[model samples]
Target chain A: MDRTIAIDVSHLSKTYDSYRAVDDLSFQVYAGEIFGLLGPNGAGKSTTLRTLITLLHPTSGAATVMGYDTVRDADKVRTLIGYVPQERAIDRFLTGREHLQLLGALYHLTKEEAAKRIAKLLTLVELEAHADRPAKTYSGGMKRKLDIACGLLPDPKVLFLDEPTLGLDVQSRLRIWEYVRMLKARGMTIVMTTNYLDEADQLCDRLAIIDGGKIKTLGSPVELKIALGGDIVSLTLKETDRIHSLESELKDRPAIKAVRATTKGLDIRVESPEKALPTILESANRLGCNIEFIQYNRPRLDDVFIAHTGRAITESIPESETA
Target chain B: MAHYWQEISALTMRWVRRLSREKFSMLFTLVQPMLFWLIFFGNLFQRAADTQVMQAPNYISFLAAGVVVMTVLNNGLAGGVDLLFDKENGFLERLMSTPIHRTSVILSRFIFVMGITSMQVLVILGVAYLFGVQPATGILGVAMIVLIGMMFGIGLTAISMAMAFSVKSHGDFFSVLGFLSLPMIFLSSALVPLTAMPGWMSFLAQFNPMTWAIDAVRPLILSGWTEALPHVGMVVLVMLVFDALCLYGGAKAFRRAMG
Candidate 1:
């Protein structure tokens, strides 16, 4: 009921027959903030976004965009929000300029108004030179930029971007991130769903880490890292056989909380890796185990995900490829 | 309704621009049916006239009506393929997310298909005139037939678009539309008159809506609306029912697809 809430979802759920795609999910995106739904594939991130944008109906509970009910007042919600789907939703036959023109028209812009907005959006996305070319001719990044540009054409108060940079090159991803930041700075409330941890860390003001249709945790990047307890000391051992000895030796160390063997190496969550380094090395020396690699850093989103879900995000992607 | 009109205008403009840019698709729209008419229908009519089975004044004129209607039907039904492609490419989802009225999407496609069909009809009519088939009606009457024929075409298009939403793949949709169209064209008086067929064939033709449409426009092509009014009413009623069914089904499908 808060007027400052750009999006308010309460116990919202979506079930396809017997499968619950989104299970009693609840979250709020405040005005003028960049909120992220971070998850792996089939984590219901896209479904959540689709429901918020009124593209899909939720089975239970409720959601609202800019104070309008997503289901009962879909047209109003649609008018207030812009949705950028995970798959590029552009017409290949239309030029970038024409695509924007058509989208603007769909948003109820007059001809003159549409044309002016098209010009400004083209410049904003840095696709002015390629505006006249068919979208099929655009590079992956160019297509993504144009997709984002189309989403912004209505000057919407809330924008939902689902996997905006899924297949983009690093440079293109960074460019999109920059534009997203600019939108937030200009008082646009953005709900972006991304599987990429680094993207959420860099762009999101706060994030909800979702997995298996549930919210694992929700906090700012720094808050999440701090919640994971301490910095991580990751090491790649020369011999896999030494993992057991390493775990047992460092298990009760004052600076170390947990020592687990991962595919790459042993991951030791520590209060202070800088202080724990000498002790860890001495333990390795005692065991006569050679270290192939060692890294000590603050916990990443992936670590936070692992701490909550007990699985890596990358491996959690459904292998079927069809969904 | 105003929003629907605006959507139609915007979509029509988009199609026009694309057609202009592509050039070849427009040319294809004009020439493909002409080729079918010239080869298949022309040869059949010539053979029928030479054998003295055709008692009508001009056999080519009789065939011309069928060709024009067939062109409209073919183009109208195939227009749904664009919607299928939109689904495949994700444009449908984006369009659904906007504030535009849902019926406007269907109307826009109907308008585009109708426009393309009209141009094809002109080309067929020109060909008919060239082949020594004189129109019994004036230009206005001929226009009336074309407009009525286009209404039927729009109805078929609505059905096809609805099918696209209901069916899973483009190939499945094409199969269904093809199956429906071929039998309707063959059973109706498209290629030959019902009087020339057996009693059971005539009975089948009585129920075929295409038969009514062909009968309705045959007079306009042969002698104009004075004699065609009864058949025109029959055709219009059939088309109205088809259009209503398609619109209802398409709206349901649209809602399902969004879900």
Candidate 2:
């Protein structure tokens, strides 16, 4: 299927004083697609998003949103996009309904239009019961939901969410994911940045694995994993025979692609774990090696990230958030 | 143009709502100056203040104009606190990301501060009336005083907002505010006539925009419009130059910060 580009960034770079935050980067976001910039903290994901939103000017190159230049036609670009920043931006004193009303007014929505949109958004975000209460009294989840509702106020052509669920609880994170999917269902193009492995894999239709101010790799989650192109079989052998002989035997097997010795045991790469596991066991049996433990699984997005960046993304994920 | 008004009014109403919600602060913003300056301090020096040098019926009458302009100075100098808080809290960034006219952010703040300054001015006038003081130029003169207070406020508020955008944090902004407010009040004619102050102090007072504002307002309360109009005209000219410089600095700082 042919898709029109909603956002095009060409060789964009942003430098702050002596440090380059984003170096020579280029990508395109298609219409009606949920695109994500997957990277660790200070990996330049937020800088790229800010440049596209016209908040920060790119030091070199340029970006366009809906064909409007982000720099030359910022006001025109601003009208077509909704941005929810990583930081919490809700006014503590204003009630949920009042926030939406104020944003509606700023968006130049008439009184009747603001009222209609406010009511619908309040209901949609499930904050109707607490709509009149001050935002200071809200939970973190409620606050994030309120921010999302605010972003949806303009019914924007593109929505930019910067770490939308960075500090949210599991329940709130799931709820946000649901809302993001619903927005996509309504044909709204979304650009989000996240460091979570599951968030990138589960939420993004296509994502760019950004690292050190550049695109390390970019593709659908499935395509990236398939590009790794094999299942991994990990084995821990009991102390009964020569591990080197077992490794050599597995290396000669046609089903096994490669074999490398790990501290615990052997890590063997193969086309199909189901077909290769029996052949490896037979070779180990011939060598009189007792298999204490064995585990086999398909390559995950983490593996794909490691393949491109040579570092596990799990290292950057917080302990509690690593599912 | 319609969009400008709509956005400014909407943003200004946000300030109004927030201010109204903080009942304690709202009450104190009006009553604090009145309690400390107009009633206690003014009456404390009622007997000590020389009427001939003041050229007024009494101390309270002369102090009324000082108190009104002083309130404008205090409120105006601190006008950017709310905007600074918005910046710190990240709401300013959100507003900037929207399609609204960016000038509306600064303009709305000006409108809100001036609105509150007008209310405070009226409250001080009403209280001064109870102390047996009245504007010599009557109702029109009273309106003129509020107008002057607002004019003086614009320059001070512009300076305050420039600091808000320029400073790295609220702590630094407060430090600068403390450094500025007391010296400005003391160096002006807010507390005493220029003749009563030392020669050097009076020389410095002449340079204070606050002094010009107070000098402009003193005649409206103690003398009539015939004596007051010239001072008003002079202060208006001074404030215009003052506001232009402040607003230019403010716009520069705003551009750098927003960028």
User: Which candidate has the highest TM-score of all?
Assistant: 1
Show where candidate 1 strays beyond 4 Å.
A1-3, A241-261, A271-291, A319-323, B1-4, B48-54, B195-206, B223-227
Candidate 2, residue B26: CA error in Å? 2.0
User: Model 2 - which docking category?
Assistant: medium
lDDT of 1 by residue, A23-107 (tens): 9999888899999999888888888888888877889989998889999999899899887878888777889998888887788
Reference contacts reproduced by model 1: 0.77
Query: What lDDT score goes with residue B62 in model 2?
Result: 85
| lDDT measured at residue A225 in model 2 versus the true structure, 0 to 100 | 84
Best by the lDDT measure: 2
Question: In DockQ terms, which candidate is top?
Answer: 2
Predicted candidate 2 versus true structure: per-residue lDDT over A266-305, tens digit per residue: 8787889878988998888888888899988787787677
Kindly list the per-residue Cα lDDT of model 2 for residues B112-159, writing each as its tens digit. Answer: 999999999999999999999888898988898888898889988988
TM-score of 2: 0.87
